[model samples]
Target chain A: MAEKKRELVSGSRLVDENSLKERLIVIFTKWEVILAVLIVFEFILFSNLSPYFLDYFNLMNSTFTFMEKAIMALPMIFIIMSGDIDISIASIIALCSFSMGFASSHEIGAAGIVIIGLLAGLSAGMVNGFLVTSFKMPAIAVTLATQSIFRGISQAILEDQAYTKYPEKFAYFGQGYLGETLIPFELVLFLVLAAIMGFVLHKTQYGRKLYAIGNSKEAARFSGVKVDRARFINFTLMGLFCGISAVLLTSRIGSTRPNIALGWDMEVITLVVLGGVSITGGKGNLFGVLMAIFLLGYLKFGMGLINLSAKVMIITTGLLLIIAVLLPGFLDTVKARRKLRRQQKESGMVEV
Target chain B: MSIPTSIKTITQRRETSLILLIGVLLFGVTMRAPNFVSVTNIERIVNDTSILIMVSIGQFFVILTGGIDLSVASMIGLSGMSAAMINQYNPGMPAGFVLIIGMLIGMVLGMINGAAVAYGKVPPIITTLGTMSIYRGMTFVISRGQWVTAHEMTESYMNLPHGNFLGISNLIWWGIVVSVIMFYFSKYTKRGREIYAIGGNKVAAKFVGVEEKKIHMTIFTLSGILSGIAGVMWTSRFAAAVNETAAGFELQTVAACVIGGVSIAGGSGAVVGVVLGALFLGIINNALPVINLSPFYQMFIQGAIVLVAMLINTLSEKRREQELLKGRQQ
Candidate 1:
């Protein structure tokens, strides 16, 4: 099987006359290109589905629906790329938001509240990192436990009450737009953070180490990479982003409840995975994730415009996740089969 | 220095630690509320834990193969709702038939998951996660946003769980029967050993002629069936069925398995350990209300216990590995 794959690759390379069809196939095979096409296709489909979808104001506003999750997805790429996962992010958001709400209720200044929220998130992340690194626990199990703990703490603190009295200026973070441009402040923040994360993930030695570790932790460790430290940093980075998202989410909603951001972790993970990041790690890019965020954001917006219930939307997202993970492998198998058939035909013809 | 003796010692030590932890928890709770030890309370705790125990056994098989079924809770909801709907419309149907139908519903869903994970080559987590939503959504679609109330249930259906056989709740009897069957199957059956072999080392198992994909399919299907049975039991016990019947129960099952010394990495653990783990959690749940802890603290304590249990499992696992290495060296 390995030899067959190699032969096919070499055979394709030897055929230097690249036809237009072949060129198109090559371009389409690139994940970014396919994603770009899908995004455009979704935009048209959504616009056609709902008359309000095409409105510039609605399109801009829809960005808020997923902006917090998008921000978290930025750091998540690094974590997933490092071959670890953190399902506790949504719980971290709840905890951080609760802390911010508590501070606000106690008459703390806006800046102080934001700082407290961020610190809470940071500490939560640190605990996750500490357990995973020090005890060498599985990342999934550790994060799963922490997710429950963090959410539980938030529940214990808030009970059924929600905190809503934030300073008016707080709304600007989530609700504000640039003068006359229809660009939301939260969207701007996400884009800026995305750029920074993209740069760090693609252009830095640190990013290379992450990929190396993801590919083979033992190999990376033997090669003198501080695998555990890199993972720890990645986890902490995820927490920091979670805190930022919590602040933005709380501000956007204009309240903080213990159950706020429930299940957001799964959504963010879906975004990353749909973006073409391999769940087993060591592959994927920021551009694909960025495109995926828009793809899903617009999808939900379009579906919402059609009056679909949240339950149906959940089903759609779940189906999309399965398809996104399965499609690439399916395509690869198809390609391999076609190649095998072609090889057999050519060999038979030569013998005849 | 022998491998078998060393393995035995490790297993014994793990069970001992679990027992010690359970004792301490019981002692503490009793000190706070002596009434918790009353016969009726103990019976209630045992009865309540029956559903968890059954579901955990199912989860144990999957975990033994180094996989997880995130969709078990959804399976529970679907099966429970299905069973309730059947009972509501067919008041004359036998209760046993309803239970069988529920199990069948679960088996079919599990088969879908198994086929996807085993044949479609999708990751277990992703496949189960997707199915989890799909199944839960199906429950809503089936019920059409309506809940089957206790008043609507047939008298016999409602009485099935409450009815006693030989001085124990029928629910407890079901749990014991399921556990015994699972214990024997895993210990004696060829397919059962295949499950452990695949989980222990997939490559080695394959080399030794184990059909990995088939085993994956079987385990997931079994998990679904168990969840289905639990779903029926849950509906009968509460005499109510809703789309949200077993929300978040999958996590509890996983926690139980981990606490029972089942390695998430797969291929080790016993039915007895799982039963003890369920008992520990059951005691905690029952004692919390008795001891006057706010209901809000339950989630926090459960989460803490899971983390602590996992930590201990990991540490002990490492020590056992070290000991095995030393034995080999000697």
Candidate 2:
């Protein structure tokens, strides 16, 4: 009779474990689910707290505030996913902006000015890529040096002066709305870029190589992956995007200074990491990053609506970055412990 | 050993090379501005770099363990502000006591970073980056956008760093004392050897029964303590504590480490080298004005020096590997 009782219990345990596994799989597999739920929670909390937060017009217009960072975050996703980093992006922006300002000073048309900005960005990024790849220097160190070099050039040139004279058409990239809609040109550009990044990250051979490199560079190299070349490309891509961001930012602000986009490097990195891209590399997805960008964008908007200081936003973003990293490890531990406990109990019961 | 071998040994030490560089810098500047080499100007350059030397030594401990404290600048701001506030509210508080309190505050902050990086499994860069902002924000929150200006501080408090002792400024004395202690600590102590072991090879260190977690926490805590002292020195010297105190100072400290030949890959560095590196940077800063170079050129020159220094270091390291390979083949 005891043996029969044990068998019956074990049989029920098997069924219970299957259902538990199914639930766990869904919850953990879809990182986006967690982000989506958090977005909903934030929306509910903010709308109730601030009367102005729910307006569609305000919401659509607020994208301008973070569009530059959002666009920067896309390439940043690629950099982090490939297990390297480029902290020099903000400085690259300052460089690009300075170049465009120079071009404008020479009466270059808007189209020519944009080209100058992009080319400056591309060359600056190439400098970083070349140093990192050819010399075999670490990305962080190379970028740290370049961060100074790029910004130093701008500071030396600008020297407490502002460049405010841009052709009228140049502002449209940063401030214009879509045809017959409330959507901003900057926001539209960001969304289109995001789509391209997401596709390239998820669909292309290059994307697969990034993952393989992130996991283990030596192993990937042994498998014929051109790790340095890939990293160099990511950095160059970073520079190009920085140029894009600089143009947008310069347009939106209508001026360029030595300190333009100061500290955006940290903010953009925070966005990428919070989006589920791991700093240690090899783990994370693009959708998770997109979800994170919006989650944070709206959070900032809501915070602004409630009349909180930007300092508070800084603290909030920092905390969110830390929690984003900590939560996954914490959840995995809990799951593992529970599973171990259940197994031990079942084994102990059978023995009895 | 032969004379040639002895000279080679002396030149091979990174500190020797840095000293040569500093000598070259001094010669170059003296050529431009004869006043730059005078006793008073020499003292001025060292005095200006005293805070940098302290923080660089602290950063050496963290980087020695293959971790970095990006939050050092922010740590300085917060602790300095806290110390200034304490001095403001209670004028009679001894400078030593205030320093202890400041260090304790920094220690706590460092422990948070250490805990996150060591036990929590967060990468050191990410951990420090997050704390960098958090601490800076907390500075604003605490001070509420207020500045503790010169007149607000007590005379005794201000004298802690700037006050001269026996014909030398206390600032230079503090820099010397900290450098000596760290030099001994890194060279003589068992804990120090353990740090080197772990950084050199973590798997091997673990196999040999070294406690990685304990060392990681201790490294950052030491960094915090030193940063705290530097904070006190900074605000005391400047006679003000504001939210932006020591802003962007982390870069200078790391540049010092790099210029000193502290391997960014970890497990090798010397206190003397770091001191000279800081001095190298210090000389450039002081000489820039003396040479009639616009201050605008300062940032560009520093960045260029770092890049050149880094390239030299890497190329030399690659050469060393080739020589080792050649020996193996033979």
Candidate 3:
């Protein structure tokens, strides 16, 4: 009995806060759970407001709208997780699409066009990776400069002209179905990639290094994390995904314009951040982000059914982002204060 | 402190090299288009750059405190659009009153951002990112997607920025006045020093009794006020205000700050550098038209120039660090 009391007084491991009651609270209060509940709530509300909101086919089709962005968000998770950002992703898309269009116009087959798009995006990403990792410039600065440069290259070449022709079968990636399923090819591709990325993030040492770097770059370096190499790879990964997204987008639209994906950077960043990813880095996960993508996608699709203007959706997104960041921060502060008070009380009793 | 060291310092200064580069640019442009170096063209370029100059100064303050306000373009749009609508509906409203109202609107917007960042602990980028679109959305809502055209505005309102003052446009005069006042404010004020201190090292600055929150408030609000002024100038000069007015303009202001050698990490920027950077951009823009290059090429060239300027800024800073280390070793 005396030994048990002593252990209780000093043993943090023995305290096992994972009791049934605590576990229930933790599971229910998880961000992903909250998002799931919110999505369900959105569904009921939208269905009541609009009759066609519940259709399964329409739901499946809605995935096409965000699958490209969702694909881009996979690598974006790594970028933000490592305390870097690439606002140039949308611009990379414009450049890649332009290159692919150029290749198609040259009578190249679908395979060659796809190769050109990926190469364009890869080289573009490499430039950003090189600028950031080698020059030690801030990620925002390098990306902002490159954002302008990449899009500008396309604008200078295209000059208000658009490329309209693509080789046959090129549209399959964007417009085709999976064998006999109603699922989009892009959607299937996203799911497979997301699963792979999720495993790499949660089941690998590389993932742990990202978290360490995000929490403290200096400390991570001292601990021998390959910080620079990891960051470079994240950027290149973002570029490759952008290429994939560009291929999908160009195929779906069947044309490439200079202004294609003009404001997509904002939308993509919003998705990641709203997915419960911390803008400051070192927090959040894939489950939360995936939920955020679907919730926002469906919310937008439902709003369209009711004929609500895109402006209202913009306002809603802004409010949600602010609330998402603020509510959690507020909760954390309260938790911290309570813990601080308890610590003081325990210390005071010991002194007395 | 010695003569040789002082001379070396002068040579190493960014401003010195920037001035030399400007001279080269001017000479090169003159060689291509002989009339480009003329005084009239120079005046025109400066006038055109006046709006960017004001906006860059505003951006400079926020960046000094290691914060970015991505909503700058949106702020410009809403404020400018608001003032333009007032002029369109009530043509009798004084231009000065419209300008003041525009500034007040911007000040309020900035205050919201400052409060969230300084007190609420929301990251500056996220706060601004959200506001960026929200403000634009609000602009559309208020305007009902209608543009305020030049013909709808009063004669006096249109002339506010274009009115000549002793052969110089009022816009150029406004830029000069703002430059002088800001230079004085930054150099002489304790608040300005606090901005630098906080940016350099937040923990150290807080320990030294600097109020990080208040500085954040001041700088962001100041940026808003400046953007407001620029908004008014833009509408008057361009003679139209639309929902998309000044869209994507935040990039140009930031580009000016970066090219002017403002460290993106913050805490170090000068008004002269910002002004020179704006001027350099302005010259390139004007010269591009004269050289017969399509305006489309302008975007490509501008991006390239900013990249070069960014690289130079980094290289020079690194060189300064090495030189300092060598001196310490000696």
Count the clashes in each prediction.
0, 0, 0
Predictions in order: lDDT: 0.89, 0.89, 0.88
Better of 1 and 3 by DockQ: 3
lDDT of 3 at A65: 88
Q: Give per-residue CA lDDT, model 2, range B1-330, as digits (tens).
A: 999989987888888888888998899988988888999989999999999999999888788877778999999999999999999999988988998899898888889989998898888888889999999999999999899999999999999987888999999999999999988988899888899888889899999999999998989988888889888889999999999888889989999988998887788888888999999999999999888988987888888888888898899889888988999999
Per-residue alpha-carbon lDDT of candidate 1 for residues A1-352, written as tens digits (9 for 90 to 100): 2554885585576366456675566557667788899889988888888889999889899999999999999989998998889989999999999999999999998889889989998999989999999999888889888888999998987888899999887888888898778999999999899989998989999988988888889989999999999989888988988999999999999998888998788789999998999888888889999999999898889989999877887788888888888888887787678668867987999999
Q: Write the per-residue lDDT of candidate 1 for residues B147-198, one digit (tens) a residue.
A: 9999899989998888889999899899999999999989899999999999
> Higher-TM-score candidate among 2 and 3?
2
True contacts kept of each: 0.55, 0.57, 0.60
For residues B46-131, could you state the per-residue lDDT of candidate 3 as single tens digits?
A: 99999999989989888877788898999999899999998988888899899899999889888988898888888888888888
Instruction: Give the C-alpha miss distance for residue A326 in model 2, angstroms.
Output: 1.5
Recovery fraction of native interface contacts for candidate 1 = 0.55
The count of backbone overlaps in candidate 1 is 0
Backbone clash pairs for candidate 2 read: none
Instruction: Mark the 10 consecutive residues where model 1 chain B has the least summed lDDT.
Output: B8-17
- lDDT of candidate 1 at residue B139, scale 0 to 100: 89
Give candidate 1 misplaced runs (Cα > 4 Å): A1-15, A345-352, B1-11
